[model samples]
Target chain A: MIPVITAFDRSPDGGKGLARDTRVRWALEEAGQSCDVRPVSFASLRQPAHLALNPFGQIPTYEEDDLVLFETGAIVLHIAERHNGLLPVDAAARARAIAWMFAALNTVEPPILERQTAVLLESDKPWTAERLRSIDQRIDVRLGQLSARLGDDEWLDGGFSAGDLMMVSVLLRLGSSGLLDKHPGLAAYLARGEARPAYRRAFEAQRTFNTRPGPSE
Target chain B: MIPVITAFDRSPDGGKGLARDTRVRWALEEAGQSCDVRPVSFASLRQPAHLALNPFGQIPTYEEDDLVLFETGAIVLHIAERHNGLLPVDAAARARAIAWMFAALNTVEPPILERQTAVLLESDKPWTAERLRSIDQRIDVRLGQLSARLGDDEWLDGGFSAGDLMMVSVLLRLGSSGLLDKHPGLAAYLARGEARPAYRRAFEAQRTFNTRPGPSE
Candidate 1:
């Protein structure tokens, strides 16, 4: 059965493919699966119907038959577990790959999201500049450690598992931050992830969906 | 073979069971499994040997034979997948449980961690009070939503699966913050989690480990 996933009616990023649905789309494309996208407006996200699907009232919820799931990481993991392409077949490699997925979300992404909070919510505050400097230092520390670990590797673990998919998606949020510039290797790594055929397809699909004229437009 | 997990030689939280290792230990106790803990000093966390286990250089990392895994969420998940008690047997239920796990780490924990950063890294800054108020509001939003969803339920989903283990662990960080007090239902929920026999065993073990007299002491 084709899964149906929820995305934003109009993405805040305006078709930049930064909306989390793109991550699920990328995973679907990589796993050789197709899914239908359901758009939820900003107002409806907090409504009862949506909250029933996800308590957090976030986007990119996955529904397949009787099962309903949210949290982009969990949804991607569901896809990876069912399909062959997103995770390695080897027992140890698969577990290690799953570790990377957790590391990306738990270890690396927190500081990045903090930066986003500082930008989106606290930008008007007087201490924004100094706070941002501190936040960026924290981000750079993680980036430097990540770059050191990546070194000359093509992927975080092995050949492009769900781990890389998550790490790259998290890193893409930093595109405008200029932090990636400090780590040329990670920048190239992000480029490599974007260059994937699956990623390209997923990006174009969201871009078109997000950019297309609405009824009012 | 027993899995060996890495933890702090001297936990910053002392013996309060707030360390990530407590999460792993709770999972092991829930699974009725026993494992060895190897304590790593703060200075050694960045060293090559520790970095080899976890590129991010955080604990607790799980190593069973040839497989080495990091990220507390991943470690708890590893224990869950290998044992029967932590995850529901039904496929859909299992997926939803995993969603809660991700929600705990990604959605719920990030804002809490941000509050930590503000206190730990920016405590002396002039705008700390203003920033903390903003951070607290963000945290309260999540807490309110979580309280509404949790309602009077004993667990986030159904039975006390790994999802509960994770959610409880994340909420435990807020114990001293007094944020949970705003939601009595959620506060009781956390107390219920701490009252679990498995959790008691895990907590006592870590408390003993952390409070033991060191050679210098």
Candidate 2:
């Protein structure tokens, strides 16, 4: 059965591929899997129907057979577990890769998301400029540590795995912030991830879906 | 071989069990697994030795045999996958449980962590009070959605799994915040988690470890 995943009907990013569905799509592309995308309107996201699939009422939920899963990390993991390309076959290496996934979402993404909250939610506040500075400093610390760890390596560990996929996706959020340019190695790292065939395919698919004209148009 | 996990020599919370290591301890207790805890001082966290294990320079790195793992979510998940207690036997149910784990760390904890950043790091800022109010509102939206989904259910899903362990751990961070009081169901859910025998054992172990007198004293 082709799995079904949800995406925003009209993404807030306007085709920037940062709405998280892109992560799932990239994972699926890497795994050589096909899925059906169901665009969910912002109004429907909070309704009982959507909330039944995900309590938090967020998009990019996955449904295959009888299983319904939410959380991009979990959904991508579900795909990676079922398919072969996304995770290493070795046990220890696979665990390490999973650790990076958590580190991306739990450790790395939190500060970046804080920056988002500051920019998107509290942009008009008097302290926005100061808060942005603090948030960026925190993001730089993580990026520095990540650059140190990735020194002279192609991927985070051995070859590209779900860990790098997640870390790259998280760092992609910094595309407009100019933070990636500060760490040349990380910028190159992000570039390598973006240059992946699977990533390109995923990005193009989301771009087409997001930019397509609506019924009114 | 027995696993060794790193933890704070002196937890900033002073045995309140808010440290990420407590989540690992709780997972270990549930799995009926015992691990040796190595005390890592704040001064040593950023040193080369610690960074070798975790580039993020954070405590609670798990080492067993040749494998070294960081990230509390990953460690707890490794334990859950190996042990029989923390995940469901059914494949679909297992995926859902894992989704809750991501939800706890990624969705719920980020705002709560922002609250931490505000209180702990930005307390002296002029906008501290206003920023906190904004952060609290974001946290409440998540808590409200979680409570609605939980309803009268005993756990987030079926029998208490790692998902509950993680969600409870995330919610415990709000103990002194009094936000849990606003959602009675979530508060009761948290109490249920703490009331578990495994949770009690985990709490006591950390409490004793953190309260122990140093040799110099």
Tens digits of lDDT, candidate 2, B1-217: 8899998998988999988889999999999999999999998999999999999999899999999999999999999999989999999999999999999999999899899989999899999998888889989999999999999999999999999999999999997898888899999999999999999999999999989987511
Q: Which residues of candidate 2, in runs, are more than 4 Å off? A: B215-217
> In candidate 2, what are the lDDT values of residues A83-195, reduced to their tens digit?
98989999999999999999999889989988998899889989999889989999999999999999989999999999999999999999779888879999999999999
DockQ of 2: 0.95
Top candidate on lDDT is 2
Candidate 1: tens digits of C-alpha lDDT, residues B53-125: 9887788888999998888988899899999899999999999999999999999998898899889888998
Q: Give the lDDT of residue B81 in candidate 2.
A: 98
Q: Model 2 RMSD to the real structure?
A: 1.2
Model 1 chain A: which ten-residue window has the lowest total lDDT? A208-217
Q: Candidate 1: where is the Cα deviation over 4 Å? A: none
Error of 1 at A161 (Å): 0.4
Q: Per-residue lDDT tens digits of candidate 1, residues A22-103?
A: 9999999999999998889888999999999988899999999999999999999999999989999998899889988998
Where does candidate 2 chain A have its weakest 10-residue lDDT segment? Answer: A208-217
What TM-score should be assigned to candidate 2?
A: 0.99
N/CA/C clash count, model 1 = 0
